[model samples]
Target: MLLDKDGILQDVIPPRPPLQSLDSLPGSLAQKVYASLKQAILSLAFRPGERMRKSEICEELGVSRSPVTEAMTRLASEGLVDIVPQAGTYVTRFSMAEIHEGAFLREALELAAIETVATSITEEQLVLLRRNLRIQEALVRDEDIAGFYEMDAQMHELILSFTGYRRLAFLAETSWVHVNRARRLNLPSPGRMQATLAEHKAIIAALEARDPHAAREATRHHLRQLIKFLEPLVHERPELFANH
Candidate 1:
């Protein structure tokens, strides 16, 4: 099932093909199934709070019940799904508390990362950042919201990578799952893409100037924008959010 941008309930749609090629993905059958399902949920193709039946999923993916059940269990552990006895499994609703928590963690880690790398960023790395911004500008012009969003994430990861702390990137990536869901739900808001491009340019400018404090501030501001965007959404689409 899916929910339209207006929060109206929509007819059920079969799961799209896995975002990544299954043959190229490195995982057992259960793990591959889990990855595919995770992407579906994150992309909102599965829809928040929609029930996920094992039989239906198996039929859609041409898989068996065991892999689908295992995948659902894994998703539940990641707080992406809830399994209720006798009630079946469901995609988890958005949680304001979780979103805030994720933002807090992401801000702290990313700030530290930028501060650490600001003074030492090599010219070569700066070139790559510039190239990314160029592509982002084109994406904005084309109104490729999904592509722009993906590049936004990659740019952050690139910044974090400069710190040489793989764990920092890993932590940021994990926290991003929650944030990305919220962003995707609230996407295509008027002028949001342009504003995002401007914000990203500011962060890059700070990096170019080798100003850690400025970069940290820009990154924080960028991350917080999502929270502001979501606050009104929670009120307008209460059905999409959890009670707690």
Candidate 2:
């Protein structure tokens, strides 16, 4: 893997094989299996550090052993789950250090992406971004945490996508797969979520004015907010990091 200056993966010389790509139409057994497991892990239905039995997963998901195996393999590759030899598979546990590192790395990449995008973002792109922010604000007010999170992900993805850095976007996305649960929890906190929307408004203002420096700062501030939001949880539940 080639890393960028910000320490994000830029490219994989021998790219990892693609996992099951289920569409809105219909999906293969493996794809369906992967989707189900991914959701359960994200929603905390399969709690952190919980052991996962292949047989149990197969029975619960109503799939065969092969699809469960494939899903577990894919989730393991993404760092969402772990496969311990001879013991059992387990959902990856949260760690204070890993959480901080992820937030820091994401901060750097997003700041860079914002700066890059601000320099070239068009009026049309600005319109679309503002529209996203509006929807996000409404969703946040409705306490629609999940919907707001999806829009938040889309907002960041849009910035990277429009900036013409698909490789960097791909790397950032993979990293997000590991930390999305924490990110989702961050949005439900009152003060943190309010600050998030304010930051989004500031970012939009900077982008609209074509101020690259302000846009970068806004992005950095937004990402750093997660560190403070998650601090209490990690401190109270120190056991979460024992295995890490």
Candidate 3:
């Protein structure tokens, strides 16, 4: 990893990592294609509004157009891509309206989950959360924003898991597709990753203290920060967003 004069990691993450190997992936051909494409899109490998040429994808995957189109169709259905009639397909852009709705849904689910967890979290679960935070701190120091994001997500899921409701995590994740894509775009901002780490620590502390009120407040603030961070991006990067 290269570092600048201040010893900060420079360009640590690529614009996109290499494409996923389909043969190594589990599932049917179409499913594998869909999974690969979705991973690329969510990870920002395929940026918003970027054209996805069928021929290029076919060449890259060494597959026919059928499966690629099939995968794209699936992505479009999920609002991850747009399928134009004659103009070829492009990744879906962000809109604050959609982002806010997704945030609202997530906060509603997570506030309740954290409240339940605060009252019932065991020592073992608390230890797991602390351990997760340690890794997140390390990732931040290393400037591994992608790794830190994964750990950040795990911390949330761990809280939901502690709630003893098997489906809440799935419900929160599946319902927040738009938010997830937009949320990641904000992580690379200077000092933002460290700020987020502090927020997570506050949440874990509230959980450790078994204070449901504190937990709810902490969770709410943490979730809202993503929206706050994203607000400026809409104007700065107008091409990456749309009213729809």
Candidate 4:
């Protein structure tokens, strides 16, 4: 806790997202099961390294053994779960090595997207982006870290959408499955959520100026901040990491 303007000490705890219902989820049975598990895992509702009881999940989602089996297989492929033959299914633990690799790949893709959008973005797109930023700012104020996180993903996907490359967003999401889950740890750090908003604004400012170099720089700087913010977790919260 830090002193406020009036010198009063205050408690500062970050709120976690609640677990979402698995009922009535849309898609094919397997697809719906996959989406539900993915969201829970990504939001840290299913804690990293915690055992996944397939029977419990099947009963909760009202799904059969086959759909649950298919979802577990797919999640394992995505690095979201580990299937231990004798032990149990478990949420994958954070690995700094994997996170670094994911960051490198994302930076390469986003820099290219930034340059593309800087030149080609239309006014309608800017309006959508600005609206997103407004919501991000409010989330930061509310200290609604989970809400802000979803908005953050939306803004990135929106920028990629502006590039008119239909497959780029899918590529980015699929490629960084581990990094996406690990990012849940970084945002709630002291001042990090607000700092993210500021960085996002800088990117938008550069985009509005129609300056590719500046926009690319903004995107690079924003992506690099992830590692900086996450570095402390390796030492401070060792249980969050694999092989700790």
Candidate with the larger TM-score of 1 and 2: 1
Clashes of each: 0, 0, 0, 0
lDDT of 1 by residue, 24-143 (tens): 556799898898888888887777788987886787677889988998998999999999999999999999999999999888898889998898999999999999999999999997
* Candidate 2 C-alpha lDDT tens digits along 118-163: 8999989988999999998898788676687778788888888887
TM for candidate 3 is 0.91
Lowest lDDT sum, 10 consecutive residues, model 4, at: 1-10
Cα lDDT, all candidates: 0.84, 0.74, 0.86, 0.84
Writing each residue's lDDT as its tens digit, candidate 4 over 166-237 gives 999998887677788877777756777878999999999999999999999999999898888677768766
Which residue pairs clash in candidate 2? none
lDDT of 3 by residue, 68-180 (tens): 99999999999999999999999998878888999999999999899988999999999999999999989999999889989988999899989899999999998788999
Order of quality (TM-score) = 3, 1, 4, 2
Where in model 4 is the C-alpha error above 4 Å? 1-19
Candidate 1 overall Cα lDDT vs. reference? Answer: 0.84
Clashing pairs in 3: none
Say which prediction, candidate 1 or candidate 4, comes out ahead on TM-score.
1
* Cα-based RMSD of candidate 3: 3.5
Native-vs-model 4 lDDT?
Answer: 0.84
